[model samples]
Target: MPDPARLFQSLSDPVRLRLLRLLVREELHVQELVAITGLSQPRVSKHLGLLRKQGWVDQRKEGTRSWYRARSGDDAPGGTALLPTVLTLAEELPQTDGDDERLVLALGARQAQAKAFFSAMADRWETIRLRYAQPEFDLGLMGGLAQPEARVLDVGTGGGALLPEFAATGARVLAVDLSLPMLVRARKRCRGQAAGEVDFCCGAAEALPLGDGACDVVQCAMVLHHVARPARVVAELARVLRPDGRLAVTSFCAHHQEWMRSELAHQWLGFERTEMERFFRLAHVTPGRWLQRGPRSPDGSGNGNGPNAADWPEVFLMTGIKDADHGG
Candidate 1:
C-alpha cells in the first residue's frame, strides 16, 4: 500500500541513489560518504536530507558523527514494496575504482585514530574501557557451583573487575596479573568490599606461579588475546586446576581489527569457538558451552551506534571442566 509515485521520485536523483547504494552495504557517517563518493560535504548532506525525508535511510548519532544506513523491508515507508528491486539494481551497478580507493583510505584513518587513542591511554586502559557499554553476561552462574571455602583463581585480573563478583560467593579469591601497576589498581578496587579476602599475585599467564591442582575455579576475562602462547596458558590453567575444576574464559572472537595487535599489545586477534574447544581438548578438559555477545551503544542506547561503533569487537564466553580421569 506504499505510494509508488513517491518511491519513484525518491530514486530519480542519481546522488540519492548512489548514497543509498553505499549505505546498503554498511552504515556510514557523512565524512565517510563524502570520501567514498568524492562529493563535497554540503552536496552529500543535501542528498542525504532528501533521502531521509523519503524514509529511504535511517540515521543514528554517536558523538559528533551521524551514521546512516539504507532502510529496507518494513523499515522503508514508501519504498518498502520496491526495496528488493532497488537493492538488486544497486548491486548490479558497477562501483567506481576511486570509490573503493577512498574507502580503503577511510578505513586506514579509523585504524590510526584507534591506535593513537589506545597508545596514549595504555596505563588507564581499564578506566577508559568502563566508559563504554559492554555486553552483559551472568558471571553469577559460576557462583552456584562454589562449595564451602572454595579456592578461585582469577587470571589476568585487570583492575579486579571480576574479582568482586567471584569474591561475593565467599570463595577465597587469588588475583593474578603480569603488570604490577594493574595489580595495584585491582587491589584498590577490591578494598573494603563485603566479598571474602582477595590475594594478589604477579604472574604470567603462560607460567603461573601457583602449584599443581591449586584452584577449584579459574576465571580468565578478556586476557587470552594478550598472551603470546594461548595454548600454553590453557595448559597452565589446566595444570593448576583440581580434577573436575571449572574454567571460564571471556574474550573477543576473531576480527579484522589489525590495529588491536600493535596498539593494545594483543598477541591474537581472537579465537573462534572451534579453536577454543580444541585448546580445551588439548588441555585434557571437557568443553562446556560457548556464548557469543555482540557490541552495543556506549550509553546503553539501542541505536546500534556509538563512539566505538565503527570498530566495536564481538566477545564470547567459553566454559570447560577439567576431566577427572586426566588429573593434574
Candidate 2:
C-alpha cells in the first residue's frame, strides 16, 4: 500500500474517481477507456498509472494495447475496509450523465465485432479449429459430459461443433449460442440420427436464458475468451447447473497471439490456468482435472501439428464440479 497521504491524494482527483468507477464495471482497453470517460488518452493513461501503482487498478498488457480494470476486492490491499468509504464518496460526487451510456456503447462495439466475425466465419470454424489446436483439447473436455438420462448444456455452442458428441452420449442435449448464423449451421450439422433429440437456443453467455438448476453438465468450449465478462459467464453457468453438475471449459492458454483479436474477433488473447481456477472458486465450484496440449514442434509433429507451429499457444480443458451446497 502507498503512504496514507499519497493514497488520499490519489483519491482526491475526480478523474481518478471516475476512472475507478468505469473500470470497476468493465475491463477496458486504453482506447475504450478514453472513449467512455471522454478524456484524452494521455490524461486517462496518466491517472491509470497512478491507480495501478496504488494497487487500486490492474492492467493487462498485450502487444501494443493495454486493458485496465479496478483491482478486484480480494486483490486490493485495503479493499474490504476502504472500498466502502471510497464508493460512498464516489456516489456522493457529481454524476456523469453520459458515462454509463458511453460505456454501453463501447461494450456494444466489442460484442458487435465478435458477432460479425462469427457470422462470416461460422462455416469455416471446423477447418479453423484444426489450424490452432489438436483433438486432445476437445476430446478431454468431452469427458465432462453427463451420462444418458442426465441433461447437458453447451454454452456458446459455436457452429454446434460438439452437438453430435453431446447427442451420442444419449443425454438430452441443448445448444446455446449468441450467433444465429452459427446456430443455423449447428442445427444443420447435427441433423443426423440423434439430431432430433438436441435443442438449440440463441443467447448470451453472460446472461443465459435458463432456469435455476437446469442441467447436469455444462460445456463451454473456446467460448470464454470471446465474451467480455468471463467471470460473469462462469457465474451464470453455475446459476443454471444442478447440484454436483459438471462444468467443462475448453480454451487457449495465455499467449501473445495478437493476430487472434483481428482474425478471430477474440476479446481476450487467451487465459491463464490460474485465472480460470480463480473464476471457478469465486463461483463456488470445485476445480477439477485439467488437460492440455500444444506449442507444436517446428516440424509440425507436436500435439497440434499445423503449419507455423511456433505461432500457436497451448490449449487446455479445465473442468469443475458444482458444490452440492452451491447457490443456484
Model 1: residues with Cα > 4 Å off, grouped in runs: 1-123, 131-135, 138-148, 298-307
Candidate 2: clashing pairs of residues:
none
Candidate 2 per-residue C-alpha lDDT over 1-328 given as tens digits, one digit per residue, 9 for 90 to 100: 5688888888899988888888878888999888887789999999999999888998988756898888766676476788767877776656555788898888788778878888898878877776655566566655656577778889988877777876876789889988999999999988775633799899888888889999899888888888878888898998899989999987888877777777778888788889899899988789998877775353453342323666777778888899999768
RMSD of each: 13.8, 2.9
- Candidate 1 contains a number of clashing pairs equal to 0
For candidate 2, what is the TM-score?
A: 0.92
Most TM-score-accurate candidate: 2
Task: Name the top lDDT candidate.
Answer: 2
